[model samples]
Target: MTSHQPPLWRRAVAELLGTGLLVSIVVGSGIAAQQLSPNDVGLQLLQNSTATVLGLTVLILMLGPVSGAHLNPVISLVDWALGRRSGTGLTLPDLGTYVVAQTVGAIGGSVLANAMFEVGTSISVKDRATTGHLLGEVVATAGLVLLIFALAATKRGVLAAPAVGAYIGAAYWFTSSTSFANPAVTVGRIFSDTFAGIAPVSVPAFVVAQLLGAAVGLGLLLILFPSAARNTGDIVLPHSAEKTSA
Candidate 1:
């Protein structure tokens, strides 16, 4: 790691904790919205999306200093991929560590949300795999990747917290799948049988769509900003591990 980067263990812990809390915010707020809004699906979505927007922004601000607050597998993978030749982002082993941490954290967050809501950890029966929903996932993930890298490339990474949160909040309404753009969060939602859950059978397609979206986003990012590769290390937000360690 570089001077600005924390050790792998610390970064991993940050990723795990940050991702866990993000899912908790998502799943917990969704459950609350369902109970609070009862029959009004629109109201429930509004409540859920609002809470997610604010909570996600807060999490990114808080954890970005530690691990770039990636909190998403696709972001980490893209960071690694983009910086491979430049050697400015995560290495292959670091990517593996990040993915494992994020996935485990996602599952744990779902379980935590279930417990908090007095619901058991049950597999979601909400089948979300349709042609339209799959297309939504593609769009949602693509937009997310494009936005993050664009900010980095443009030296606007400092605005990532609010910008990303706003984009996701907007996507919640525009997309059919509610923009479960993060693979880790997508898997986490599988453990909840509530409003934000997804059926296990839908996971593969969703993941595939997300990966394809990442590719599209990457292509767009490279074309739009030829210097994106050099700025890959600043994803999500910029922070110094050495500064924090001291």
Candidate 2:
């Protein structure tokens, strides 16, 4: 190994590349659902949701070993705030790097989706979210980020693929934003004209809602597992950190 650690830039680049890949899968799958549907929107939604879970599952399993598959900025920020990461570190600058990478990656992913699907603005924003919908989104995303924190923060229980996959699959239908805690993913969907795509104007609200959700999730997790506070050794390092070190 080199004497010096891989600079923060490489780690940041990995995050950007990984987020871009995830958005491509998410947006592309949404487009596929629309193209295959005739009038059965329920079936279309099922297809869209299924595609999302499968894509995310594989991405997590694959990238989880590398980037921690964070893809979601909220997840990264919360982890850093929790003081879980160690020798390698998760600094504010690191948080900035991750978010920037993920955002730029999301933009690239959205552009790719547009180029592939030829969607200009088939599905655009409607209006400011209603109080109920906003609340629902907040609750949903909070649960999502909490789940990430719970899975990463603790070490006693194993986070097998089936358990995590099922949880994500279930979360999608339950949330107003369909449990999209990833700001990058949320922003990228604006480029698509599919049922799964969000309107550009509506994206900011979703981001705010998710940030709130993450806070809620973190609170609940801490409350439920007070004992876990002592142990955060494993959760800190990005899944890829080990690889880069090796």
Name the weakest run of 10 consecutive residues (lDDT summed) in model 1: 237-246
The local lDDT score (0 to 100) that residue 138 gets in candidate 2 is 80
- Tens-digit lDDT track for model 1 on 1-246? 336687889999999999999999999999999999999999999999999999999999999988899999999988998998687888898899999999999999999999999988999999999999999999999999999999999999999999999999999999998999999999999999999999999999999999999999999988999899899888888856465433
The global C-alpha lDDT for each of the candidates, from Candidate 1 onward, is 0.93, 0.67
What TM-score would candidate 2 get against the native? Answer: 0.83
Per-residue CA lDDT of model 2 for 102-149, tens digit only, reads 889987877787677777745455443666667776887677666665
Top candidate, metric lDDT: 1
Candidate 2 Cα misplacement greater than 4 A, ranges: 1-7, 84-89, 120-123, 126-128, 156-162, 227-246
lDDT of 1 at 195: 95
Highest TM-score: give the candidate number: 1
Candidate 1 overall Cα lDDT vs. reference?
A: 0.93
Query: If scored against the real structure, what TM-score would every candidate get?
Result: 0.97, 0.83
